[model samples]
Target: MSERETWATRAGFILAAVGSAVGLGNIWQFPFKTAEFGGATFLVVYLVAVFGIGLPAMLAEFVVGRKSNLNTIGAFERIGYRNWRFVGVLGLLTGFWILSYYSVVGGWVLRYVGGSLTGAYFGDAQGYFGAISAGPEAIALHAVFMALVVGIVAFGIQDGIEKATKLMVPSILAILVALAVWAFTLPGATPGYAYFLSPDLSQLRLTVDTTPSFPWLTFGGPLAAIIPFAVSQAFFSLSLGMGAMITYASYIDGDESLFGDSATIVVFNTAIGILAGLVVIPLLFAQGVEPGSGGAGALFISVASAFADIPFGRVVGVVFFLVVLVAALSSAISLLEVVVSYAIDNYPVSRPQVAVGLGSAIFTLGLPSAWDTAWLTWFDTLAYQLLLPASVLGILVFVGWVFGRPGVEELLRGTGFGDGVGSLWLWLVRTVVFLGVVLTLALGLLTLFGGADPAIVPPL
Candidate 1:
């Protein structure tokens, strides 16, 4: 209607965006990937992708959403030529697909919050986690979790999404930092550090080869497979490419320099994830927990088991779960904002109608996920491998080709940094930057499916 919606305040906007960036992926995905792939090498490749690839692509999406002031669908149609609507539609559907299970996992975080607070999981948390990982309990919790999301969206952007995030993000960050400091002193932490912080090129070579025991994917060698995984994790950890960032950017009101904002978000998101690594990995090593178990319960099982053994470990467990709970909800809210904004902008529907209708639809789709770990893994892998990269591809096409250099330059005009290089930057975005993502995606797909080899490096 009237240039869509804007964030209530700048602080809310940053927090909401940060909330999306910092989530369970930061806690679970980053650490596990690092553990399995070789700590510093994986971290190194991941950092490269984050700044080299993710930063450019994120700025591209910001240009599209902020300039047009629209959700994924509207942003695409307004910017691109014919048939781009299909791409736009795909992005919107990806958002829905992500929310379905993201909220479900958010519910698990809620469950763990109770588990931590009650000291329920402190004794046999491995068994405790196994029992509640899926089925009706998870579904019911998901529904309750979705309702909370609805309440926030119902209040609209400024008052609802922004306000809650402003309080939640800082609190989440603070607690997580404190927990990491405490965990640094865990007894078995030396071996854990040896496993987590030490660089092992031999180990990296093995994982890159996709050894049978460490078979997350197949490639010519651990190095070959790792490039794609690192690239994907970099994007995944940042919550980039999904309409979450694009839609969040759509609400911006000023020339606050998209690169600076996006960079700030990326730095914090990566730090929180590294902090998670510091806390969880060393503890796993300390407890004699196997780094080889890169399954669904990376943090929930091994790390949780470690929590049971420490002095006042139960207290630590509660605080850690609270960190997860806050991070999950904050991300869930950012995702829900995308869908709600879609309906509000495109239809005559009220925000409440949009939230309830779409939220229910997505929640139904997530049933199979809650029923089966097999399905949940498939969904998570699909989102990480397919939807996320595709979303980045969409932005590459949108800003690099559709809107062109002049349009992008105009968006960055009022910024404080280099003002004259807009044309040069736009040219780079259209050609080099866009092509790099394409090559990464194409090479990644080939290396993933085509390059099957057997190897396993020793643990980091």
Candidate 2:
């Protein structure tokens, strides 16, 4: 095999990781989910979950990747845990499964970028979104988006993924900072900030009646009702549980501080998510559109409609959607990398060939979702409810139980941290992180099979 590729710089690696985490998950999903689940109430739960559960889980993937310096599957086998290679296999599958629908969403962002410049969706944002969200147009755009991803990955790591993300991540942050400043001056900005940042603890503990029409109705508490979605949102927002991190970390050239880098990536990702909410939520409020009014298309429909009446609306819309497009492409690159890295690591195929071939196949798999919005919704549910949580749980188990001390040592290298910290991290992964994921996965299954409240489960 040819020599493995590595990141051009430490900053390049950090930006690439942040780019992976700071995509549609932050821009498209965060505001809508915050709106749907009582605004700041959801925000609080999401923060707790991100730090408490998401961070440790991310550390586990970092350990595996940098230690073995290989793709997810080969990382396991390289470490002499051949049987546990299934964990990496699951991650590869999760990344592939996710990008199928993720590409569909990326296509949506691309369409919105065009529509913003032409004011195509200004008059009837909802109608326009409904019209273009599925069918031939969506499929065509999805293929376009996948082609962009394939083109980038075909250029190899240093020239393609790293360089692209260096530009994209910084551009995204700069645009969002400007947009958030402008959004603060909107008439309803106060209420929007209050809704997004001010916590209402009662909403966090809210309950629901499963069946109001019959005696079979069962009531569920906040813990059972809300934790799964919040946890899944954390996983989704940080790009955890998919081995995207593992694939990216494999490119690191030296012994960097994994803990420090993990924390930096987490901070950047979470900040982008909050900045997105600041921009979108206030804009929705400014238009007098109630939160959650637009359903699954909340970010697209609600924000686009709000732009119709604002000053310089067309220009603002163009800039905003351009930010979304950049974020989407950055994330799509990471997801495709996971699959492309696996193919080149294990087979005789070249990077360009694997990128194009796998990109085409993934696009074919996503056609169902592109053909119908209902299929998109189904894919979203399956990801949050099963694929993400399951992949995360498996990785934690491997690092904590299967890989054992060697994995902990990998994590602590170059951090100047003692064995005590490693032991604590391992303990958290084994117990808190592990059990928390188990509970999240179990609750997701219950929500799927036991008919949990639709309000608690994210319909998106």
Best by lDDT: 2
lDDT of 1 by residue, 98-177 (tens): 77887777777788878866778777776777677788898888888888888887778788888888888888878878
Candidate-wise lDDT, in order: 0.74, 0.89
The weakest ten consecutive residues by lDDT in model 2 span 210-219
lDDT of 2: 0.89
Residue 223 of model 1 has an lDDT of: 60
- Per-candidate Cα RMSD to the true structure, in Å, reads 4.1, 2.8
**In model 2, what lDDT does residue 47 have?**
93
Query: Candidate 1, residue 264: CA error in Å?
Result: 1.1
Q: Predict model 1's lDDT versus the native.
A: 0.74
Residue-wise lDDT of candidate 2 within 206-241, one digit each (tens)? 354666533344436665666788899899888888
The true-versus-predicted C-alpha distance at residue 72 of model 2, in Å, is 0.7
Q: Name model 1 segments beyond 4 Å from true.
A: 1-3, 80-82, 201-219, 292-294, 427-436, 443-460
